[model samples]
Target: MKEVRFFYAPEATITEELPQDEATHAIRVLRLQSGDEIFFMDGKGAFHRAEITLVTNKKCMYRIVETMQQEPTWRGHIHLAIAPTKMMDRVEWMVEKATEIGFDEISFLNCRFSERTKIRTDRIEKIVVSAVKQSHKAWKPIVNEMLDFKNFICQPREGRKFICHCYEEVSKEDFFSLISSVSQEESLHESDDITVLVGPEGDFSIDEVRMALDNGYESVTLGKSRLRTETAGLQAVSMSNLARRI
Candidate 1:
């Protein structure tokens, strides 16, 4: 049977009835019939394999056939602090792709050079859900509230940390190089736990870069090409995971 996945905001489980909107989507949109199989998640890494027992315009009830519980992820931890772009669409795209690529935590830094001042929460969250479903991933990324640029840069980062920046400084290493040099420990991939910072479209100021260094973040470059804020962030995420594949 084809599986339909839905995100329930309230609460959910193998026993709990799905919310109205989900029921509508399953019954009205997907034309899910009784006894059909589907999947639902609480977006907290709890995945339920459900079979439709009752389907109605107002509500739907499913019997939990299987329950796969996942711990809240810190696995392959990738946290990105990015500067919002002048065009909000870029940032929205960044969120969608980043979610698809998989990141544990995401934060926005309101950098001095940031062209875009405010973010549309509705738009970004919408992208996140679609990407989460598209990638068939059990976990979702937390899009944090915007941080003060200077304050953000000054914060200490636990575990392995790198700040992707442009301009000549110490010779920058390819993300793959950094990912490769770390030796794997136990079951976990080495360097799987990481945090990266990508600045805004306008880019981070000199002071911001300095603040990051003060906070223990190593200044690294992604390459010679000057990438947009969103591109840099997404690329870092992609590389973070792809390193495991290589």
Candidate 2:
């Protein structure tokens, strides 16, 4: 049996030709020819099955044969906002794994104790696209630009909000348990969104944690063991995903 290949085409339904990078891969790397079957994802909950109609040196055009809308793997939107690690590869790995596990969105946080103040979102976006294809996820997670910790917490947000920290002074609840309790509630809705904040390796400063708490963000813990920045972010996402499963 021939393997099925999926390509990321944000406007797959509107455009007959693949994007430049995807086109290059299909024509040069895959050597796909006319009449070859291919699949495309618009990253917006739909997949298009197509057959290559024309293949040129620079472009690969296809005719859509069928379009299918995919249901989300999990209920609600799970958003993770974290401070990027000094080593970018660690952050990249976390994003890839989280994408596979399933999540709605991710944002970078410039916390008070952030080791790295800046991030290359373009690179991270590429990695996310690759993961979406690899996982066969219908909806691509939205990547937001890095935001100051203060500004991010102050922004108006919907649904449940949480901050994961390790300050002994601040009373906290177990993240998984809190989410699970809510899941059992009769008020629980599938559209309910959850956003969790994860700090850097140095962790959010005491003052920063206080600010988040002041702004309607509940304090939560991801168990007892101390985790690295990337690990904590991935764990937060994993917990959120699991809660939805329950």
Candidate 3:
């Protein structure tokens, strides 16, 4: 049996053809010919099994053989909001890994101590799409434009909210432990949303932390060792993923 290749094509259907970029890859890079089997994810929790029907240098047409709806492997919606690192590579790395690990949404925060306040979401979204295809994820993660620290923190959200900061004066709890407790309390559904805020290289300003706290975002710690902005973001996602296993 041949391993079925997965491609992202939200608009693909039983009659529709693969998109130009996907078609090009299928016909050129993969050297796929007519009758070769492949699958496409709509990035909305659905997958379509397809077979190539026509191949050209710039286009590859396909006929859908079947449609499959996949349930998410992880529970709840995991959202990570972080200040982009000074170096774009670090933030991009985090985005890729987090997508593979599974997350629902990502927000870029513009914080007081943030070294980089701007981000090109177009490039980042492409990275995210690539990650989803590479990871075989059925649902696409929502990537948002960068927002001011105070503005982002004040936005209304549901489920357990947390902010990771290094201020010792402010009481904090273990990230994983809080996740566990939040899940156990109130007999919450396994799919309850979790939103975590991670700061930049300089970390969130003390006043910013205070504002987040005032806005009902609990203070939490990844661990004793201080983490870089990108690392902290990934750690938050990792801890949340683990918390669901309990």
What lDDT does the true structure give each of the candidates? 0.74, 0.92, 0.87
Candidate closer to the true structure by TM-score (higher is better), 2 or 3: 2
Error of 1 at 45 (Å): 3.3
Cα lDDT tens digits, model 3, 124-171, are: 998998999888889999999999988887788878799999988999
Best by TM-score: 2
Which ten-residue region of model 2 has the weakest summed lDDT?
A: 182-191
Q: Write the per-residue lDDT of candidate 1 for residues 21-129, one digit (tens) a residue.
A: 6677777888888898878666778777778898776778888888788664334677888878887878888888888777778888788888866777667777887
Question: How many Å off is the CA of 179 in candidate 1?
Answer: 2.9
Report the lDDT of model 3 for residue 149: 85
Q: In candidate 3, which residue ranges exceed 4 Å CA deviation?
A: 183-185, 189-191
Whole-structure CA lDDT of model 1: 0.74
Model 2 ranges with Cα > 4 A deviation: 1-3, 183-185, 188-191
Compared with the true structure, model 3 gives a TM-score of: 0.92
Error of 3 at 30 (Å): 1.4
Q: Model 2, 152-176: lDDT tens per residue?
A: 9999887789999999999999999
